[model samples]
Target: MKGGKIGESGGLTFWLASPGDYDDVMAISDGIYEGNDYLPHRYHSWMTEPYRVVILAKRDGKLVGLASGLIVDGGSTVFLEGMRVCSREQGRGFAGVIQRFTDQYIRQLYPNVRMKRLVRGEDPRPEKLAKFSLLAKRAILSLQIEAKAFHAFLSTLRAKLEHETGTGSLEQESRLVVLEEEQLRHILLDPGVSSQIELPGHMIIQDWQPLKLVESNFEVLRRRNLTWLADSLEQPTFLSLHTPPYPIPYKGGSFRFSIDLFGTKADLACRALLAHMEMVRGAPQLFQDPQTGGTCC
Candidate 1:
């Protein structure tokens, strides 16, 4: 697999993943997440049922960069997960080439997929990772922050998409993700995603409250859902957000958190609550300007 010349690095290649390429793929994966923690093991499990792709960049005879992704639902959706370039090959536009090629490749493979989802971890500067002597565990938390930021950014982009399509409700147009206590327990205990987290089920939800977004000035509507939960000390709280298609005048977003009588620890729940609130606060910033679209639509 190859892409046309762009920016600095020229003549990039795109290729499909094979059983034999697992070692090389693993090598690239190690380089990408060498010290990062918090990333679920499922993030690196490529042999799963979903389709996978590996796009490699080479200059002369040595590898310079690589990209890995998966096709969900017969290529209707593409998830660009991991991407990295060699240490010596920095500063060039090779990263962009990999991204563009992956986007084009998915479109060519699955014409029905209305959109593509790509996520890059928090460490934008690969060079810093090599120079910093930070503990591996701390580095992982940094990576988690990056993952959360990426996820929140994606959520914001979904909101923008609703506005562009003239949808009445951004929440309705975008997928609503439910993270219930039962579901959280499953996620933390499930072998698939939980095994990666040492503190899986231990991270309790302390509180949950509802969220709402009233139309204000922006033509774009806000995206909120009843999918999040806040765990309380004695009970688990269910948090939900109800958003209008467009901003409601004079009324800010309204949300409710249904606290369960029987839940988890207070500190754990509060941490989760704060994280969700922060996400809600940042989500709308992407739509602050009506004239701009930031990879969401």
Candidate 2:
């Protein structure tokens, strides 16, 4: 793949990644992730995958960042697999440059695919939720219950149905209600019913619009820089970027939940969290601001 230069500084260059770039990419990933479980370990496989696109960014002949995207759902959806920037090189607007270029490259390569990613968070801070709403426009609560808990709830519902209809077990009852995934999603999203489930885990699931290349947004990001972005947030409180060994608030017990922001600002927090999600799975368009209930450009 051909390489191109980015930024007016004349130091940054970007190119499609190959297996040969694995070592350099991993070095950057290692520095940024620092043994974090969220680091991607399948760079070689991604380099060879027909539906995957990996982009590497270099500055002064040194690897500075790497990003990858994949075509999923049989070519109907494009997922950003991961992205990483060198520890020392971060906060310099390289992320926005790399992301914007990669997004455009992916769309050109797969014009027919829609872009989407899953954003999962448990009891997210109000600021984070607001930022997500600005980007995704839609969010749902996900309730994950233990199998035993779910079975108990199902059994009780089944018993009630059987009593009312004078039917046998659900397997033999023609009128039995079999809850589909959509029904569960609906129930979890419904505020009235959501609190009643009392599931072990609660998370907000954001369904973002397909990714698109917006030169204007990237240009704004580049000019203003991450520091400016950080200072722009309405609420500047700090939070931890690490996930816990287990989801918190177990059994409604008071558990100490803390995020050590280390003085990072809200915009950086938003970017870091979203970028972390991309490494594990992982938008653009005017979205409705959840806080203001107004459209965000």
Candidate 3:
């Protein structure tokens, strides 16, 4: 997306995001998502990504609001994310103004974009969002474990999985298969293989980022450091993707671990989940976080 002056309205001026606006944007985004906002981690790259737009709102030369959209699915769909407004500037309709600005900008610049998509945490009323159609709803589980106690936690978890599944170490190892980024790209691109893979709404959503099985979309997915897993390469019955834990603002030095599991095999799903956690546990010091002066995996 290009960074330039957008339309001004009622003392508010909109513009595309630039690298220098990082601090101002983060200033107003405090406490967002209860300290789990992903904007800080993705802002810089979002500015440089192709076919992606990040719009900002300013009043009297001060940044106050922000929104972003990514054009994907061969320019037929735009995924909206990272919409925010300053703490003191909320409840004044700046957020909606930013979105509407983005809407017109897409129309003028990216006429190829047709569908607009987003993920909301709360259930919305049908009358309020009549223009949008619901694709699917998901239930999420969150766990909190201190870094010092994570190993013990994993040990206990492994024991429970073993006891419930009646599987020893060797047998469990033989039951799981891990795929590389390129391999996953190849697998998803194969029409026959992807047609056979199970998905709700037939969509591949990695942590709320809806993805299409197109070559360009696959390149966008490759930007993240992820672990791909499946039951078998020849004919996979289950699939999973894991992103390494990264520091969050919850406790000042804590990390958030995320997992996206696919397929419906009850026992196989359990094995895949454990396998992903163990993969992270095996390398506790993978990524370096400058703020904490420590490593997170």
Candidate 4:
């Protein structure tokens, strides 16, 4: 908790967050995101991540604000996430103070990180949009389910879909395929796939992260634990990236899943979504909190 010249501009002392700050940071974060917050699961791990810093604000030794920034895209862009302020400090503008502190820290640490990027659940106003280039936008949907009945629910959904479509044993396997992690770079960066698949805004947005399809970014992409699927490895009609489910603080406890599909064909995208769903239904590691039946949406 090194502090002295912290938040001089806003009269709040700011410093880099450490594992010791977990309880304090989380105490103020209670009920954030309507109890579906992701920070609880990511805080500890975020401290170990390179090119990232979790900034905290304190007044008279009390934790009041928190924000984080990470240098991604080969140190060319800084992505901000998990920004929060204690309820007592909300109306006092401490949120903006911590944000500026994080920004200044990242700037000094990574002078090459010229671009600032962030993902917002709500749409921004015209003035806010004018400062940042409009990268890409996606519609998000939510669902809820029980942890004990997780696999069963997935199985039921798959069975119902197959029964309705009459694809009991064939339609999907013959149409969709998953590529090995080793094949990701070759498959995704291939001229053929790039030419065939629609790269929205010519950028790769996964988990709300915008990355350019370049060689430098491949290493970063590989770390995301993404599962890649396409119609064909040689010449793909559609592609999808699935991020396995992870825990969140929603309705007590829960897991979060994401599917990013690239293609203009509505029918093919639907098929790919179903295929991805079937692929993860049997993965036991994703949701193991049996006592807590959670939301899948």
The candidate that achieves the highest lDDT relative to the unseen native structure = 3
lDDT of 4 by residue, 165-265 (tens): 68684475457778887677887677666657877667678877777777667776787688888777777767888877777777777777778888787
Instruction: Provide the lowest-lDDT 10-residue window in model 2.
Output: 280-289
Which one is best on TM-score? 3
RMSD of each candidate?
Answer: 20.3, 18.3, 2.6, 2.7
**Candidate 2 segments whose C-alpha is farther than 4 A from its true place:** 1-11, 37-40, 118-297
Report the lDDT tens digits of candidate 2 across residue range 199-239. 11222211221322232222322221121111112222221
The whole-model lDDT of each prediction reads: 0.40, 0.44, 0.78, 0.75
lDDT of 1 by residue, 12-122 (tens): 555554445545544444433333311123233443333566566666645676666655433455656557776667678788887777777667666776645433335
By lDDT, the better pick of 1 and 2 is 2
Better of 1 and 4 by lDDT: 4
Q: What are the TM-scores, per candidate, against the unseen true structure? A: 0.39, 0.40, 0.91, 0.88
Q: Model 1 off-target regions past 4 Å?
A: 1-9, 26-34, 37-44, 72-76, 120-297
Q: Encode model 3's per-residue lDDT on 1-297: one tens digit a residue.
A: 456897887568988889988899889888998777778777888889888889988998899989888998888889999999898989998877788888888878889888898898889878757989887787776776655566777788788878886655636455777897767877778776555667656677888887777888888777778888888876676788888776666656557767888787877777777778778866555334444432232
Worst 10 residues of 4 by lDDT: 1-10
> Which residue pairs overlap in candidate 2's backbone?
240-259, 240-260
Sequence-dependent TM-score of model 3: 0.91
